[model samples]
Target: MRIDWDVPITMDDGVVLRADIFRPVEPGEYATIMSMGPYAKGLSFQEGYPGNWNRMIEAYPEIAEGTTNKYQNWELVDPEKWVPDGYVCVRIDSRGAGRSHGHLDPFSPRETKDFYECIEWAATQEWSNGRIGLLGISYYAINQWQVAGLRPPHLAAICVWEGSADYYREMSRHGGILCEFLGSWFQRQVVRVQHGTGERGPRSPVTGELAAGPETLSEEELAANRINPGQDILDRPLDGDYYRDRSPDFSKITVPLLSSGNWGGQGLHPRGNLEGYLAVPSEQKWLEMHGDTHFSPFYTDHGIALQKRFFGHFLRDEDTGWTQQPPVELQVRHPGEKFVQRSENEWPLRRTRWTKYYLDPDGQALGTTPSSGADLSYETTGDGLTFLTPPLTDELEITGPVAAHLTLSSDTTDADVFLALRVFDPDGEEVTFIGSNDPSVPVGLGWLRASHRKLDTQRSLPHRPWHSHDEIWPLEPGVPVELDVEIWPTCIVVPAGYRIGLTVRGRDYENEGVMLPGAMYPMKGTGPFLHGNAQDRPAAIFGGVNTLHFTGGVAPYLLLPVIPG
Candidate 1:
């Protein structure tokens, strides 16, 4: 294989972006696989994320089977593996984050335009067959949706592996609540390797060049060059241009697409994949859901083969058995770390029995009958409430989006509600899974800030409440109002005698489970996807007691997508 280091490609605005290209030695116009992101293209996977890297390698030793794994980068296709398969792999560091020189504004229209221009450039390259396929995980995958919407002429297909498409709903804010992950992530990942870090940042082993940039700028200058997404998100409380600019218009994403999500990737990954598959106007689209650590599965043999098959069919017109692939593929989660692969024609499965388990506030139980009990109140700073179902009489499968309808009131003007769907064995032990980030994640999670409860009826599905975060309607203290909370989709199969539990809290969910040895963060139920920002949930406004009211001409229920055989 041939490797080109730091190939300069000038954008329309005259910013020269740097890309590393890997192609076959005897290449004669091959289809191109490209990724453009803030993550330094030159930074190796093992160096950028040592914790995840070591864990993935230990779990799947075969990931290092073939050619030297030296070229592998985080959330990107391994050029060593793909180049031999007759494809050119190109990785470009988006302007301002890596070796590229420019102002740093992630997910901005400027960056997307740069991606589109890069696609056109890659297609025209001598190693390209004029067909470009976008493939990556997380940040790399997120931009695929953005550029695809622009409908770049040379773009042929997209494989969005665990990417968040809705910047507001999935990433920055969840159910209109600020998620601290965005801010913390910027500081830990992006800013650390940002342009101008130079001598402070590590060098790429392959090229022996600074992974950031060549010049080291003063701290003040570096701060001035980029926008702080955390502060920006907090400044724009209401979703508008700020968030929309980062999100994708699914209707305009007409390319053949494979939107892959993780069942345990709460907070971000799941919603976008499901929404993209359901909303995209593309005639050929597929959705695949799985379970595991965020980056592990993508590099596994299973993931690489699936990606190659899709890109193979769309970019090179190869069969690769992709023509016979199902529109929706799911790795149904069973207790004890087992996943059963299943293929289906559509999401929410046509045979889904939409089950409504009414909430009995007094008894703290979920039953078939509506509650006739009194209102339940809990301190906003404490565990709100938990409603559980009786042990199941038979095996049950829940494989789609989940929702909750509740009547709530607070002594203050607003309330932030955090909901977690969990399962417990007859012995009373909680059944958790290895989430994308969190090690002990619940079955599903949902959040809603009472103020931003207005729904976009046109976009709201019975099992999914589409919040219109365009405006905020603060609550009237002591007045009960109904709220529809949309839970990120999940897939779980519970055996007989197991029980389902829904815990409503005022803060991020916590599981006192033992943290895995190499886990990045504490194995709390929510992982690093936290939302306890003091400014967002200030003491004065959201510190009062919150009430869950029912039985007085009011009913609260959990809407579950139960798939039956």
Candidate 2:
């Protein structure tokens, strides 16, 4: 079906953000699906992000079938699918990215205002039926939370797929530890598509001018006009207003949303999706969790159907057979790269029997009860302690976010605790999964600085733990302090003959036999001392001789979200 594409909308600021509008040529109004973000609007899935796009298409071949691949953009709804279904799919280049004006700084307050304006503009178009919805993955998804909070009049609904809510926690810092993802991400992706001063890049197939603007400025003019704000991110290490402005205020977001999360996306995406789903005040919300390569399912036939169903209900006012659907749909992950579909009434499944395995210092094993009064202490830099369980006779599935409650005395005022969940086979070999950092790594991991363990009870959920970065709780030299460490969520199936183990250490988890494979994108290195490197973590910030005090009087345990067999 031939549809009108690459339509331009001039914002209030006189900056024209280009859009690819796909709608039926027949004289009929249709609901609209709009997305605005970086990652270039014209860059094809097969050409721009080949590694990710290829994996996605390979796993879901139907994505590439039956349509001209021209309308496919990175990390957003495929226009071909939505346009033919009596909906106009609109893709906009956010100001400063792709074919948009202004400087390239993501999640900036200014950019959010632009998004709000863009939404209203789309709503007023001749082809729009006064209803619009936001749909996309990652960048497009992340910003929806921010804009939805603004409560645009035309934003009828949103499908936030695998987007993060807390910028500092998910994107910048992991457990108060600085992640190199921001720096590497900026260098590799953002800079390339940044709006330039000249009429470069793919011209709008409709306008024939540069997709961004009247490309009249020189390269120097483009660079000079942009805001090079990378330094601000590096300087701010806490959850200050800078991060807050970029994050979504859950209270203000009331639009119906379908929040999607990935089971294996521990580093940046999954946590926020879960957080947004739970935190948003929207009573009309749904949660869908899936397992697969990060970028695949969002574009697949299965994923598209879900997106269309949700958008159709909200945007088109169509009874798309989605109302009776389960509120939560999870692609329950199984061993050997298999997935089973499961429906649930709510997240952290009501039947999720929260089991706590206490740390037995004497035998270094995880048990149901504490072995009273036996205090054991270990060097902060040493192997620390491992609490292991014997091989299970039956298959066990542990999914969702895990936490560790520790009662410990530290030698110094501050300490860092690194928690790792490892699966060991009968022969004692560690089971590893393909991680973004390392191809072969443990199933799940989490970390926390002992002093930074203050909890925000109001924000904390049973399955998800939220920390208050409001103040630091200093260690009392030798007095035992109770601390809870929040680990990123994961889904793993431990078959019979495999043991579940929790390793509490002072540093990051680096597999000695594995060299850090060059990531598809560059990431900051953790430094020489494997696990938590000392260079990235200095004595002043993370320096402290830590100790784990586990005894009979006080039980330190790992909280597991074990799904019933």
Q: Best by TM-score, which number?
A: 1
Which residue pairs collide in model 2, if any? Answer: 99-212, 372-552, 373-552, 507-532, 508-531, 508-532
lDDT of candidate model 1 versus the reference:
0.90
What are the Cα lDDT values of the candidates?
Answer: 0.90, 0.75
lDDT of 2 by residue, 168-255 (tens): 7777667766666676566567766677733555554434555444456677776676654445655665668988998999989999
- RMSD, model 1, all Cα superposed? 1.2
lDDT of 1 by residue, 1-565 (tens): 8989999999998998999999999959999999999889878988888778878888899898886889889889888889889999999999898999999999999999999999999999888999999999999999999999999999999999999898998999999999988888899889988899999998998889999988899889899999899999988788898889889998899999999999999987888888889989999999999999898889888999999999999999997999999999999999987998999999879999999999997679999888767788988888779899999999999989899999999899999999999999999999999989887889999999999999999989889989999898999999988999988889999999999999888888888865566555567878879988999999888888989988566489999999986
TM-score of 2: 0.88
- In candidate 2, which residue ranges exceed 4 Å CA deviation? 1-6, 197-230, 372-385, 408-413, 434-441, 461-463, 474-480, 512-519, 522-536, 539-545
